[model samples]
Target: MATTDPLGIAEARSQLGTLVARAVHGHQPTTIRRSTTERAVLISEDDYEELLRARRELEAGHVAEAIAAHDRGERETVTYDDRAALYADLGLPTPGERS
Candidate 1:
């Protein structure tokens, strides 16, 4: 579905019935705006839950834990050659090679 333009609180409230109807049928989401500036959003219950779950995963430090696990056996040193190799691989002149 196409993206709907942002809506203010009053516009949303006035058309609340239609919005609910559209949402029930899985129509496109409506972006809620306020004071000519964007604010929170109104979305289907399922979508809201998914958003919350994603936020919780980020806040609970799950990402950091995963990174720590992945780097368990990796080396900690970073060298000048590493930077030079990366630059060469990307077809970019290395720091000292620049004219």
Candidate 2:
């Protein structure tokens, strides 16, 4: 079974190889922290991919809802000029502008 306890940065650094072995072969997860702050989590590749898949599903759901709202005319359409101005306001590069 995987341990649920958190490990400090120093300890985790020392036992990184062992922790990685445990996570890969034993399907265990190690939570590494810096002082009292949670820093990173070590998990098996399967778990990491699962997290990515879940995130993608969540984003897809949001997109679908937005599309439905747009079909119902619940959202206002913006012109290209408006989009360019909004992007400039947010300090984001325009479609063709390089960073």
Candidate 3:
């Protein structure tokens, strides 16, 4: 989901007050760029905090669902006698082994 066009650093710097007002009062987020690279975003404090809270809630819900699934025996369990063989099968490094 892309927002409005990004503002260059120079333009943003010159219009900091206006940009802040737009983000806060107009509920519009502005992307700030350095040269051609996107650097940061300007959004209301309330909106930022709300986004953070929503992310945490979503993560917590995922964790709870995983726990419930485990409790219900909905997950598969694999036990490998040779840990190195298991890692090789999965194309991953065994414990204490460097990639």
For TM-score, the strongest prediction is: 3
lDDT of 3 by residue, 1-99 (tens): 225678888899999999899889987888888867547889999998998787667656765775687689985555778978766745555656644
lDDT of 2: 0.75
* lDDT, model 1, position 87: 52
lDDT of 2 by residue, 34-95 (tens): 86764678999988899778766765676577668778998565555676685564445555
Off by over 4 Å in 2: 79-99
Question: In candidate 1, where is summed lDDT lowest over 10 consecutive residues?
Answer: 90-99
lDDT of each: 0.63, 0.75, 0.75
* TM-score winner, 1 or 2: 2
Clash pairs (backbone) in predicted model 2: none
Q: What residue runs in model 3 are displaced by over 4 Å at the alpha carbon?
A: 1-3, 76-99
Q: After superposition, how far is residue 51 of candidate 3 from its true place, in Å?
A: 0.1
Cand. 2 TM to true fold:
0.66
lDDT for each residue of candidate 1 in 1-99, tens digit (9 for 90 to 100): 424577778888999888766665775577777867557666678776886687656544643554475589443433446876755643455544632
In candidate 1, the residue pairs with backbone N, CA or C atoms under 3 Å apart (3 or more residues apart, or in different chains) clash, namely: none
Please report how far candidate 2 places residue 94 from its true position, in Å.
Answer: 15
Q: All predictions: root-mean-square deviation over Cα?
A: 12.4, 6.5, 8.2
